[model samples]
Target chain A: MKKLLNDPADLVAESLRGVERAHPELRVDHEHRIVYRADAPVSGKVGLLSGGGSGHEPAHAGFVGPGMLDAVCAGEVFTSPVPDQMAEATKNIDGGAGVLHLVWNYTGDVMNFDMAAELAGAETDTEVAAVVINDDVAVEDSLFTAGRRGTGAAVPVEKITGAAAEQGRSLSELADLARRVNDNTRSMGMALTSCTVPAKGTPTFDLPEDEIEIGIGIHGEPGRRRVPLAPAREIAEMLMEPLLADLDFTGGDGVLVFVNSMGATPMLELHLMYAEIAAILDNAGVVPVRSLVGPYVTSLDMAGCSVTLTRFDDELLRLWDAPVAALGLRWGM
Target chain B: MKKLLNDPADLVAESLRGVERAHPELRVDHEHRIVYRADAPVSGKVGLLSGGGSGHEPAHAGFVGPGMLDAVCAGEVFTSPVPDQMAEATKNIDGGAGVLHLVWNYTGDVMNFDMAAELAGAETDTEVAAVVINDDVAVEDSLFTAGRRGTGAAVPVEKITGAAAEQGRSLSELADLARRVNDNTRSMGMALTSCTVPAKGTPTFDLPEDEIEIGIGIHGEPGRRRVPLAPAREIAEMLMEPLLADLDFTGGDGVLVFVNSMGATPMLELHLMYAEIAAILDNAGVVPVRSLVGPYVTSLDMAGCSVTLTRFDDELLRLWDAPVAALGLRWGM
Candidate 1:
């Protein structure tokens, strides 16, 4: 595999070093493996934290800042972080208010974040809570996940909850808001190609030149179906049909739509897909209030995309528009 | 040929539709094919405009906003825009303070923008000035360019010049700043694979599985050499050595290092590469005062990266830090 790395075993740490040097506004605790906002631990404000496998970049780490995540604990590529990393991160971000963990729904991630929360509860006097994201509509189960796998919606959940937390919400309130946001979001993805795991040193799956895989997971797990490659309009229909059917999207509810690149898909294709998606939503009488089209959440160098729809109202729209200062998504700051 | 578009002919227009819908803060003039900041044509501030072929998402179009380009004119993919588009954009953005055209040093771009300026000069009272960017050091001359091809330095030039324009700098002052930025900046790029132009329905160039092309242009033009694939550190050296040799970079000058993914390169690998770059800079007693690593300027779905270093001073640093609101790079607002 042609990848820009040295000693595959040291990918995560080395990347963190680069991440540390890139953003002075960010404080990278190399020893503890925590990426925190430079001005973190705001007293009396809820602390927001998220962590998952490292391949889905700009997710946990790139989203670390004032109005999104206070700190992010990173694991190895496609691997879960140890409990100590999360525990230390929780302790540091925990001010007098509390800490909240936004864990993506994976067996290892769920278990490890749970262990870290328990350790933080036993070791520190800070209150802790978590909202697990399981928004993927592609499958009810996956290879490494118990239920539906969390996908693109994790980005919006982090942004919305962080905004609420910035407004001085309590621990329980933040948890409830997180759960609400997760419940209202749904995502579906497809892959034209598979990404190679660095350790594997080869592509995870081989795709025929003329065929495409639908409902594929972020990590190359099997999806709902594989079909003949088609135009972008058909692909959008295939992905969005299930999402629209699964969610109770109300007319004039003011929706937020995200067309995310899995990895290698360019913005040209994503925007083309978004144009089709916008037409689909318009035909359904749903007004798209906000639209984000790019690689906010991605698999490593995989050529595909995921579609996410979040039913928006006054509160969610406000939170979505609130100032967020993160590397991945920043506006109004 | 695996791109997400209904018809290859409609790629540019459809993407613009999505672009218009995605950012309500910016206005899309579909007729003339220009992206304008919603509150453009500030009375006393000099107007900034840049444009080129499509496909390069977020380059000219994504750079349009406050403290950046007041307007951007977009052409078809890899094809120069007609003079009418740029002429119309010039007339609209000129608010008594004149307009600055930042053209990349491509034959089509220079020829067409020159025509547009002449047209605007004959028809209206708006004064037009331009500073062409030609910082790619891969070769003194290349495939489609007269001297050198403009690549990553286009990003910093727009940013620095935009900041100066926002400060009410005269048209000539902005032109001088742009020249200074272009003269001090040097860039070199390499590609692991080739990208397919939509209209062509095939890869632009052939790259073998084990061999890579160094010093590639954004349009997939041939580079200086094709070498056997190497590790990220060695590749970093290959890229940085040429850049260092091309310019007189100093220790106390305060550097702005931009490691840009051509397209399709993941952030993980980019960060990993950045680690190597940071170490190389440190060993040379140089500190990167600012760093931007991602797909800011891209060739459509090409798997490669480019490195750009801008020897920075207090003026450039202040301009870089200036707040600009655009979709691609937005912060400090």
Candidate 2:
């Protein structure tokens, strides 16, 4: 409730305004709440778009740029963007190479993006493809998602698929690559503190200070279970074991590791967590080809971290090494 | 208290271990608590070095790379690094072009870095120049500081001076440029909640759910005042007015606005605050040529932000735009 916001209802619009101003590299449609790359609709290149609630910043919006998402639609905090906004973004992003919609595995987001695909198809002749991401191993299903909730895997999915798309991959090719990345990726997260939704003006959930929640989702939805607080060593093991088991990560065929901060967590802790994760993976003989540690995807102001490991091949590693220029994750461009 | 740490005593060493594992681009000295460029002593270039307490992450350590600081010494959380570590980093970073030590304005840091300069000079024959940054406009003097506390401006100063050093500026020239950047910059911050040091294992200060501390330092030191919680707009004004009054950010010479998060603050709130700050500067007729919004300089897990504005000219602007490659803040490299 102690957020630095004006009217809670204006959170999305005001933050979008802030995003537009802070990053002249992007353009914001205030009405539809769609953030688009200033130079969108690249000829002969597939358009990439992702949309979701506003709280997990640097996600969909931060991913909009060259070699990544062409457009991102913003919704209210922890709420999905409507079909209208996605449709508009789809229309603007398509440059005849087709449009790819990266939909997280949330029910509202999936349905809205589906409706947007139809509307965009009807309104324009541009072919559209949808790649659903649901890599979170936190739960079998959740209140917000039918299966696993999409979490930190979206970052690399966006980046790798973006690189593939930039290499003139077709809609189907990009869709397949997206799915491959998603299938090869697994994520698990824990929360030391819950985040408050601005409009609700309170924490989404309650817990005593001494305890922690294991397998927590991005939206403060109920996780698998609650547990007593543990040190970074034990916590990193708890998070990493599920991910390594889900993916047969072994030997020299290394994986790309992403230790994402679930908001309100410091880089110090993230680095500490990353070190523990590296040590754990090293002990298992799993080499980390690439490592990223920071808050790329988050749950508002939640205090925690998530560990994501994406199985990598030569092609995937090459694609992952591709340059990307986005507000959320930019490098080598 | 709810930190993902192994032991309170091992936080600094553990985090540095994690840092070395996560980033292959830098080398960490566990014994001396120093993080240096993996490829140090770039032939004829002036070596840039910055160090301080460990808690303010991505600061000195994260800035160690090709175009930034050649090495960074990490001390215990919120405490100044020892003179031995600085002297060792100074000796290692010297590339025959001398070493430039960027010290934050703190009683302990200044005293220690000054000793490091003498030691480095006598032992290694490395001519070291030290630049003490005191850019915080929040307080003229505080408990931890003899004069103004160095805060958010260190980011720009390191970045700009690093670029100058890479461009073959000597130690004296880099020192002068560092001083110019320090003088031209002004910063003010506020906190909605206090940070918890791992050792202390408690909130740095107490606050009711409804109040905020204005002009809070990076160490949770006292600021200008504590006032009732205000909206993002009013709070933006409170931080910006003092900075604007301090710097003559005028026409043709747009200032670089760095809206830094005080750890634990979400980018959503930072972006929202950035919009208000942009509007405020627009109303004041001062153009912001460059803007960076994120948690660059942080107090361990404090929930708030600081606004830094650095007046820039053509050369400094070019230097600001130079490529930097680091784990914390990497771009254009």
Candidate 3:
């Protein structure tokens, strides 16, 4: 593969070195592979943390800064981080208020974060609370997940919970808020092309040029089905049908529609997809109260897009609009 | 080609619809195919307008907001916008303080924008100034450019000049500052693969799997040469050697190092490349006071990256640090 890397084994660490150099506002723990906000462990403020495999960048590490994640444990590519990394990050970012782990509902990630919480409780006097997010309606189980795999909702979940944490909320309150955000959010993804892992110099999966994988997982896991390639309008219907059926996003304070590029897809296509989705929503009488369109959470060099809809109330909207300085998602600051 | 689009003919207009729907803060004139800041003609603020082909997204249109471009004209994919759109945008955004046209140095773009300036000058009372950016050090003359092809430096030029305009600089002053920023900046791009323009439905150029194009232009124009695929460190050397040779980025107030993805390159690779570039700069005793690493300026789904270094003075640094709320680049607000 023609990737800009020296050694596949050294990819994550070397990339983290660049992240450390590029963002002075963040502190990187090279040994443990943890990225922490420089001013982490805010006095008496709830500490927020989230992480998964490293390929879905700007998710955990890029979200570390003021008004977002306090720390993140990055794993190797699509592999889960060890419990030791998470436990160390939890201990370090724990303020007097406590620490909250926002775990995406991948089987390995959930298990590891659980073990990390247990380790933190046994070692330090930190109160660790965990919230598991399972918002992907693509499948009930995948190759790497036993339940519905968490996909795009991690963004809004982290943003809203981090805002609540920045407001000095308790660990339990942040946990509840995160769970609420996840419950209200639904995401579905499709892939036109598969991404290649650095370790495996070939694409993670094979996708013919004339076909696509609908409801595909972020890590090239098996999706609902493979379908013939179609226009964005049809693709939007394929993604939105299950999402609307799974969640009641028609009423309340409207929905926060997030149209994200899955790495290789350009903004032109993402915006075109957004217009198709927005047209569908408009016809369905679903008002989009807030919208985010870009590549926030992405697979590595995967050509596709995902749609996440969060039914937001005033509180969630307020928190989303709050000033944030994270590299992945920054606004109002 | 796999892309999320309906019809290639309707791509630009449809995507602009998505942009208008997604960002309520920006207003889009569908008839003129121009994106404008919602509060255009900001009393006495000098207007900043930039545009070119549609494929290089988040360039001109995405930069329309506070502390950035006041208006942007959109052309078809990889095609220069006509003079009518630019003239209409100029007439609308003029706040009685005149307007500045930020033109990328492409043959069609330079010619069309020149005609637009004349049209605006003769038809309206608005004074107009122009700054043509030609920061690419790839070649003295290329397929579509006379001197140099504008590449990654459009971001900083628009940013610094936009900030100056926000600070109430006159039209002539903004034009001078833009030109100064352009003169101090140098950029070089290398592509691992070729991009597919939506209309063509084929790769812009042929790139074998084992080789890469160094010193590639943003629009898939012929680069310096095709070379065997190398590691990120060696690739960084290839990109940096020419940039440093062309511009003396040492001394003064240091340099602003920008590592940008040419669309398909992920943050993981971009950050890794940034580390490699940083090490080279460190060895060269070139201090980087500010840095931007991401896909700010991009080609459509081309797997590659470009590096830009601008020698910044205290004034330029201050303006660079100013708050910007554009969709493409947002921080310090």
Assess each model's interface with DockQ, reporting 2 decimals per model: 0.74, 0.83, 0.83
Tens digit of lDDT per residue, candidate 1, span A1-333?
877787889888888988988888899988877999998898999999898888988677889988999999888888888899999999998878999999999999999999999999999887899999999999988998999999988988999999999999999999999998899999999999899899889999988888889999999999999999898889999998999899877764588999999989988788889988988888877788898888878889899999999998788889998999898989878
Reference-based lDDT, residue A19, model 2: 94
Candidate 2, position A190, lDDT: 94
Local accuracy of candidate 2 as per-residue lDDT tens digits, A43-131: 88999999899899878788988888889999898999999999999999888888999999999999999999999999888688999
> lDDT tens digits, residues A111-149, model 3?
999999999999998899999899999999889999899
Considering summed lDDT, which 10 consecutive residues are worst modelled in model 2 chain B?
Answer: B244-253
lDDT of 1 at B99: 91
Clashing pairs in 3: A333-B333
DockQ, cand. 1: 0.74
Supply candidate 3's per-residue lDDT for B38: 96
Better of 2 and 3 by lDDT: 3
Name the top lDDT candidate.
Answer: 3
lDDT of 3 by residue, B9-84 (tens): 9999999999999989899999989999999988899999999998888786889889989999999998899999
Q: Rate the local accuracy (lDDT) of all candidates.
A: 0.89, 0.89, 0.92
Clashes of each: 0, 0, 1
